[model samples]
Target: MTRCRLCGSQATASVVDLGATPPCESFLAAGQLDRPEPTYPLHLRVCTDCWLAQIPPLITPEETFTEYAYFSSFSTSWVEHARAFVADAVERAGLGPEAFVVEVASNDGYLLKHVVDRGIRCLGVEPSVNVGAAARDAGVPTLTAFLSPETGSAVRAEHGPADLVVANNVYAHIPDVVGFTRGLRSLVADDGWVSIEVQHLLTLIEENQYDTIYHEHFQYYTVASAIRALASGGLTLVDVELLPTHGGSVRLWARPDGVAGEPSRRVADVLAREKAAGLQELSGYTEFSARVAKVRRDLLRFLVEAAERGETVVGYGAPGKGNTLLNHCGIRPDLLPYTVDRNPYKHGRYTPGTRIPILPPERIAADRPDYVLVLPWNLRAELAEQLSYVHDWGGRLVFPIPELSIVEGTS
Candidate 1:
């Protein structure tokens, strides 16, 4: 952590130091809960040279993603988002029956399934054994391995260079930013495109989305830093799109250095926005730590007062971001006795650091708690509707990030 992971510079600045917490997705089994749980320093620093905000690479992707607990298909909105992205990408790239598409870190073929439906040749590079099996079961061709330079070249040799390589929500997950970008460059044809969707540091600061910072997400990006990261891999930035996923994300389109045409005007427009926000300098980050502290205080106050009133409060999702929120706020089972998730794999397990029990979604209805805390507030629209039944018993939903607020029902 002394040196920047993206740039080899010793001059770095502290952004936020979310105290030690276990790996966000490391849900513990009942037997293991009795044993000691390991925690690491969950601190994020920015490279003064490159402006790339990152955390220490304390955990490897293999450790967390091999038997991954998350399944992209579980979220209805996410699945539809993937479907729409596939359709738009195909049309924009002039993809045909003969065109080959590949998606790195493809979870359970959520995005590639749409490509399969269109009869386009597609492959999924997923590291998780269990989720990769699910992708295969769903008839999406998959290779079980992490994305590295060697892995990318091996795929190219076996199936030929892809026309389009899609990577979503995984660009920031790798510690070796330069190596991962090179691997991405190795996956596509000389003239093919690589589209990546990663959380934008701009909105993360503007909206107080510090909960998204965790060990798995090693680095966060701005358009300026992203352009530099792409150049390190021998790729040229072509276009950019502002997206609503993961609080706020940027969809970057790149191609081989020479083949990539002049940069799009949107790229300059977004860069202008980032510059206006002061993200390229130290001024943008000075107040972020203060805002993050306020978020922790406001949520803790609500949970404590509710407990004092003898009112019951439970959590709604066991996402990685939720784990960060819970651990950073020092919340324990005494305040949030249990949380429910749609994924059955975590049904009987416990959250990594907080030790809060994870139950099935139906448990909320069965117990009818006074309040249901929605941890994955990024999906406010979707979960608000899914949990509309809480209104039946006068149970309200609470969102902790951006500000603690209560909602009667669907937004």
Candidate 2:
């Protein structure tokens, strides 16, 4: 019985299996091209008691992030998002040269760099070695280790309490969620704020974003579920903001117990909207598997049709979500000639399981393929603009999940 990691709820309610898939970030080395790719069962289940959507236990964080490949600084849109987030938070929180800020899972210090530029003391707790080194090189001091109650306590003892603790897109990745959140109680100052950004479970189900499922992403969160989990760890939600990033995410501002942190009206409003959308009910889980299956079917049909017509199809953005979508749809080199990535680490590699080569974006211009499939559909607009040069060849871009559509004015 795989119990709920946060609430210890042992009721294994509804399981939606997406069958064997490879580690989303294990984009293969170039030499291993011909070798058979390994995959593991990709199944998701909902905790009936807590209403948390989670994947069954399989891989460990060490297996996922030790030598992580995905670098956040590579994406222009993501960097811009990070910069804007830092600017707003610093201003909103009155964090200036005197404040101390900490960011958990601060991959390559993408957001912290902006905070550091303001001369405020900032620290990063990152588990991945390679990415941590990159951040250090960028002059962002980072602790190359996982965040836990012990680490948080030690840090608090040494550096004193933080004014702002940010965990962007990381609340969903933690396994020892309760312990981690408990740790927050030690590090966050009495008047400090801890902001967590997670992909909303309500949005995931309503929008059919099953592609977000991957081993690294252990939990999908909702405002109600998050408040419940945080309350258990002695934190209270103060405010909530819905963000447009990652197909729709929520930023929950919290503080330690008895700190006068009341859950905002927006929090209640969002939870009400979530309940109205049926996230608290079992019916929401019923159609997700079928919707995921439909995604696989529709995508395969489109890829095979494109292949049959002798129209070459390629993929853009070798993101973790793209890996899930590709592996689930069984896309191979034959279907997607290759995928392009801006990250140099993934440039010469092959996507795990799918074995589709990940080359530089130059491949898109050189090949002049008929269609370029935008895998990270959330960044479709940015990528489309970047590849507008494809218009010269009369080629068009294709976005599969959410909906299948081709950009106009090109082949």
Candidate 3:
């Protein structure tokens, strides 16, 4: 029985079983041809006691993040999102020159650059060597190590307590939730705010985004679950906000006990909404598995039918979520010849299990396939609009999840 990682609760309720899958970003290298890639059992379970929705253990941070391939600076939307988040934090926190800002899992200093530009003392704690090197190249001071209680205490001794600690999209990645949260508790000053952004579990179920399930992402968080985990370390949530990035996400601002300030109405309102949606009950997740299975079946049928008609189909976006969807549905080069990505580093590589070659976005215009499968369906609207010229040849853009549908026209 897979026990909850946070609390030693053995009563784990199975949420959604995505089946065996490789690490989402484990792209095949030329030297790895002979080495058989390992695939782990990928399934999510909800802790009945803590309501923590997480995938069973697989890979560690050292194994997954070191020499990482995914770079945050590659995404245009994410860059802009990071910029906006920095602006919001500065104004809301009343940040000034005296304030020391720290960001955990700060990949390539995507958000920290903005904070540094304003002459704010900031440091980024990142694990990935390649990304940390990039952060240094960009003139952002970064510590290349995983954040833990000991490390946090050490950093605090050197730089003093941070006024604002921003951990964006990292609350879900840590294996030891308790230790990581304790580290945040230690590093932050009494009056300082610790803000974390994570993809909301409610949005994942509502959008039927089973593709978000992967090894790197250990936990799926809701507002209630987040508060419960934070409260374990004596932190209280003071504010919360919903964001559209990565389908849907929640940004939470927390502080230690007796912090002065009224709890934001949005925080209470979101928690109530989560309860109303039956997140506290096991039945909510039970229905999701059936819905996801249906999606897998329908996507396979559509691809098989299209192949029978001798139609050419290619994929767009070599994102981690896209890899999960393709690998779970058991898609191959037969259905998707090759996917294209804007990231230059990923352009010449191939996806893990399926080994579908990842090419540049320009390949779509050159090839002009009959149908283009938008695997990163969340960004389908933006991608479809950009590639609307495929309509000149009567080609359609197909989105698989939430049912496969083709939209005509090119921007």
Top candidate by TM-score: 1
Model 3: lDDT equals: 0.88
171, model 2: CA deviation in Å? Answer: 1.0
Ranking by lDDT: 1, 3, 2
TM-score of every model versus the real structure: 0.99, 0.96, 0.96
Residue 379 shift from truth in candidate 2, angstroms: 0.7
Q: Give the per-residue lDDT of model 1 (tens digit) for 1-411.
A: 888877799988999899999999999999997899999999888888999999989999989999999999999999999999998899878899999999999999999999999999999999999999999999999999989899999999999999999999999989889998999989999989999999999999999999999999999999999999999999998999999998899999999998998999999999999999998889999899999999999999999999999999999999999999999999999999999999999999999989999999999999999999999999998998999999999999999878998998566
Residues 278-342, candidate 2, lDDT per residue (tens digit)?
88888767877787777788889988998889899888889999998988887888888889988
User: What is the lDDT of every predicted structure here?
Assistant: 0.94, 0.85, 0.88
What pairs collide in candidate 1? none
Name the runs in model 3 displaced over 4 angstroms.
Answer: 260-262
Better of 1 and 2 by TM-score: 1
Candidate 1 TM-score over all chains jointly: 0.99
Among the numbered candidates, top lDDT falls to 1
